[model samples]
Target chain A: MAVWLRSLRYAAILLAFTTSAYAESDPIGYVKTHAGAAFVDAGGETLEAFPGLALREGDVIRTGDDGRLGLTLLDNTVMSVGPNAELVVEEYLFRPGEGELGLGVRLLRGTMQFISGVIAKLRPEAVKVRTTTGTIGVRGTRFLVKVED
Target chain B: MAQRSGMHGGNLLLAALVAGLAVSACAPKSWVVLLPNEDGSTGRIIVSGPEGQAEVAEAGTAASLDTAVPETFDVSRGEIDTTFGDALQAQPSPPAVFRLYFELGGTQLTPESAALLQDVLNEVGARPGADLSIVGHTDTAGAAADNEALGLERAHFVRDRIIAAGLKLDRISTESHGEGNLLVPTADDVSEPRNRRVEIVVR
Candidate 1:
């Protein structure tokens, strides 16, 4: 009886984990300008989300040529993703006067420079910038990111 | 006029009391970790919570960067190689080598580089008693001083991640060789991708 009960509890935990993973939102805005091929996991298969494709955090934004991409983050952080650039929003959360906000991104490919704002400054720990090689736990500051092939 | 002056004083006192109380109510639970720059500067102070994760609630409470974060370091001018040589000799082999590539004047590690880190981490985990030595190298780009610091930062970036991943703090050593050391030497005028890298080796 104890074994059965433990198994049930494990199943419930697994369900909760899978549910949270599905909660991520879709891209709200499209790519402003893409010099190279930009692919998106449209529905299931990877489809091209080129110029005019709406973009959001967590969207795989890539540049074929040495191009650039402009993304408007949830907190209105304007991120200019550079060519051969790959970036992802790992997590983003914002809370008002209580001063709690979380911004997390992973830079996979090229370069990205951030200008911190209310969200990033109010709760700097809420912001996390990750890379293939490492991660940057940042606050309200200006910094640049360059990822290579 | 005297009565008005007295009232103003009382109001000011009340305001001050309220502000003090508010600050106390919202003050963040704080902790500080000294993040040394790859360069030789005093380094950065990363204030966070129990897990070293930045607490947004305390972002305002924690101090801002008091001074410039060392963005660059040089091996030739800084005699940094000596520090690294000593560290390498004493350090254990890294479980794996995490390879990185960079763009010109850039400090970001690309996707392919990140994937490489995953493998490196696995290798580190597989081997017990292994320490990591993060050696950074820069291309013969701009000035020697700039490349030196850039290489150091890249090495630090790797070291910090390994620490964050719950590795033993004492198990890792880091060093940066700016533009002074290159895998593919250019003729004083070329930028090579081979040089811009942070290599993770088991000690």
Candidate 2:
């Protein structure tokens, strides 16, 4: 009976730990609105900012004065966009011990720069950045991308 | 006869002497005249003195004494530019002393950050007629456009918060430089807290 009770106790502790850990990675603020042009890390490739490019973990975003931008994933992958860029944060997760880490980014227009980070390293498949071209995957360790029309 | 002959001869000698003295008294005195030579002409001279007459030729031109003299006059002209243009071109300003902060990947205001904002606001409000520009910046973690927008949003957010706390909106303007004006450069793997901030430029 004592052995069974110890097992139950362990399970309860594990449940509590899981719930609390989930709470920490919540976003404090989000991408309100980016004017002109912007860029996002769409799956693995970079998306030029148009209307709704979102932000995700391990995503690096940049904008030019005339509206150019570059987006990079956490692993140092890159995506460059041109003038009047805008981006949005669609989905993101960075909870420890959850065994799951994902990030999503969308580019509206302009330029972008994306660099990979924790999420891309821990869960390579979970990382993605969306752009006008489509969702890009972080296959190579580091890369540069530019989109314009 | 002898006495008469002597008288006649003496009378004749006296007459001759008188006549010679009269001729000497009638002659005019002579004067020496010297004239300066003109052009290539030669000089002529006359001597009335007992010595005799001699003429001297012209000497060469006199030399100037300007090389030995030093300047005595001093003058100053043109004014220095105290306006913004010259100062901006010659010397760009260093980064501001205080900065604005945000919660990680989010816009939520933490108690520590709230207190910091209050301090900045108080510092600003305490001084009247202090026009300020609230510049926002972000780290290299996000996309460039996103970072630019993020920077601008952060700046505007702070501006709104300060205005909500009784500060004048008219006294402040917002500028988002994004990651273009980074305080510290960071590697692709690391997240630098210093670069993720807002600056209050008090003018």
lDDT score of residue B186 within candidate 1: 84
Query: After superposition, which runs of candidate 1 have C-alpha atoms over 4 Å from their true positions?
Result: A1-30, A39-52, A95-100, B1-71, B74-203
Best by DockQ: 1
B4: Cα error in model 1, Å: 58
TM-score of chain A of 1: 0.65
True contacts kept of each: 0.00, 0.00
- Candidate 1 residue B39 C-alpha distance from true site, Å: 27
lDDT by residue (A1-149, candidate 2, tens digit) is 69999999999998777745643443212222233444445344565543223334444454555444332222222333434445554666765345757766665543343444556667766766555434444431322222334
Candidate 1, residue B74: Cα displacement in angstroms equals 8.8
The CAPRI quality class of candidate 2 comes to: incorrect
**lDDT of candidate 1?**
0.52
Judged by lDDT against the true structure, how good is candidate 2?
A: 0.46
